[model samples]
Target: MGTKWITFDLDETIMQNPFGKWVFPEIVNMLKKETDTEEDILDLIVSEHLQRMSEERFLEAYDWDDIITGVAGNLGAGSVIDIERMVIKHSESPKIYLLEDNMLDYLKRIKEKGFHLAAATNGYSKYQLPVLQKLGLDRVFDEVITSDSAGFAKPNPAVLKKLSDDGEITAHVGDRIDHDVLLANKLGVFSVFIHRALPAEVLAYPIDERATHPSFIKICEEKWHKENRLREMPFLENECIPKVVVQSVEELAEKIGFILK
Candidate 1:
């Protein structure tokens, strides 16, 4: 094979998107209950977003108790641990989005062709595997590697370098422009940018490929349910790259084939 292996970013590329949005509303309610307020939740939301926007330390994952107190104080929620309990109890779901259609078939074909697949993500394997299991991509991926696993995140060439030695063709797919597309270019892999959970402004950044279809969509209702919940990351059509831009995994697979063959 010309391209012996391919790497992937886990969060928005293959499964449901996670922007901490899911936990926002519940946090607001918790703030209100704890602080005793009939006020709208927007204050709480703005407070939280600003709080973690690079002023103080920002974390991808956090404990329930610390977050509640900080957010409550920021938004003037006033002593709300019980509400924190409510938010923690129902804040997140391990079950996330799955693939769209015919994508899984394409992966099976690639696997039959003897291509290697690995997930190089910024999250942890333990947390991400559950998400993959929910999407059914967990079992299919030959190797699963993450920032938590590797001790670093995207835009870092070291993670991509781990996929293969020099002289082998590698392809990377992901949703973030700055993190995925830009980094892959530097790492010398055929890179794809996904618009699943992005916005027009952010997506306008150029990527080697603009992907429109899921690489591993399955037909099961459980899979479909997850797809429905995928955060709508969008992009501008004007985004361009020196390489070919494609909309489906079949297209990506073909590109990899030509390069590797």
Candidate 2:
């Protein structure tokens, strides 16, 4: 099959966002201000942060005020409104993103291989475009389309169709299977999922030699829920499992190298 275009997701795929990198410290301090003594709230903060990170759709269902109200009540905070303000302020911290280690060089090598590159991410163009520039990728992508610009977001056929209409065979890569892999499979394009690594327990089992067991989708869903059970699994149709799952950007680069070659 013809394949030329290679698009990527932004946040976790090409960048690393440390746990509570933006809000944890501010939230802790804000809570401490209302109480004379600090309570053991770090676990609560981490749980809330992980919920926000893993449950993408759940966050949109409610506003920050609602989120803060629930979190404050759970934490028994002195001021709900004040905590809400702090939460909103810290949410903006994602704007300060750091590129993955040697990701620039890795992407450059792909470009040198003559494959067209693009970024298809879910966010407002106003915020997303700056992150690319900050990561020195504004010029790297031949095209960068945001949900706001496209009038749609990931897992939306409209966005994928728009990219496919370019008439270049294409593949989309990302860390999340429910979005990236499902969308690629729906469009009948190559699906390359880049997982960081196998779980410690499963690491010993050779992926190639393992007997029939849980699907990758199941494995990821379990981990996702365990880390953030507040949100339900986006689990789309199992019919669209990724054609390839690699452990790192380097492994993906090598696979892409084969495709381009």
Candidate 3:
């Protein structure tokens, strides 16, 4: 057995994206349905604005008048084409996710342990990278594999293979079993599940070990979806499963500390 590399998911495992992050899909779904009410289309933004404290601060700091002008200018409000400034305003409202408490420190520790790190996420690189940049999250990983960047997304061998190459000791950490863990298993790397708030009965596989504290799923409220929870999957018929089932990165370092030796 060789030393392993560690791969992490972005939104739930290491950071808190408070802007109805999971519900973005639901909002997009409304757009897909072509809902008539601007309110209905933008309800997620309003709901999140009223809910998340970080976003409330973002709203307060934004120059409302400048925002209005920007929206008007960008959409060409007076042009022959139609415009929905109200909906646009809600949609563009500085949606953001911040670092988990001391997560940067944890990441640095990971690097110090001499493990190669990569980010294996299934979302927007354009949107996601900015969040990472804001929190210095970008510094943690030597590589970042976004589904979009990889072209085929998660549960796909192409996306997983980007990190799997070069013989790094790679393990996948993600909230979605279907997307992240299952995909990692397919690629022959170790897997770890965060158990973001999923019912035990709901899982497709028994999580290698369940995290009791700092349940990352609830911390992000994405626990309702499969995003916050991570399921450490067992080795497939041709793969290997990691022995460590730790609550935090610190413990992961300790359990795998021997690798450094």
Leading candidate by lDDT: 2
Top-TM-score structure, candidate number = 2
Per-residue CA lDDT of candidate 2, range 87-142, in tens? Answer: 33443335445445678778877777777788887655654554566567777788
114-170 per-residue lDDT for model 1 (tens digits): 767777776645445655655567667877877656555566676655556633536
Q: Which of 2 and 3 is ahead in TM-score?
A: 2
lDDT of 1: 0.53
Task: Please identify model 1 stretches exceeding 4 Å from their true place.
Answer: 1-3, 17-22, 36-95, 165-169, 195-242, 259-261
By lDDT, the better pick of 2 and 3 is 2
Model 3 vs. true fold: TM:
0.56
Q: Which stretches of candidate 2 lie over 4 Å from their true place?
A: 1-3, 17-19, 23-99, 199-218, 221-237, 259-261
Q: What is the overall TM-score of model 1 with all chains considered together?
A: 0.60
Error of 3 at 170 (Å): 2.4
Name the candidate, 1 or 2, with the larger TM-score value. Answer: 2
- Colliding residue pairs in candidate 2: none
Ranking by TM-score: 2, 1, 3
Shift in Å, residue 260, candidate 1 = 5.0
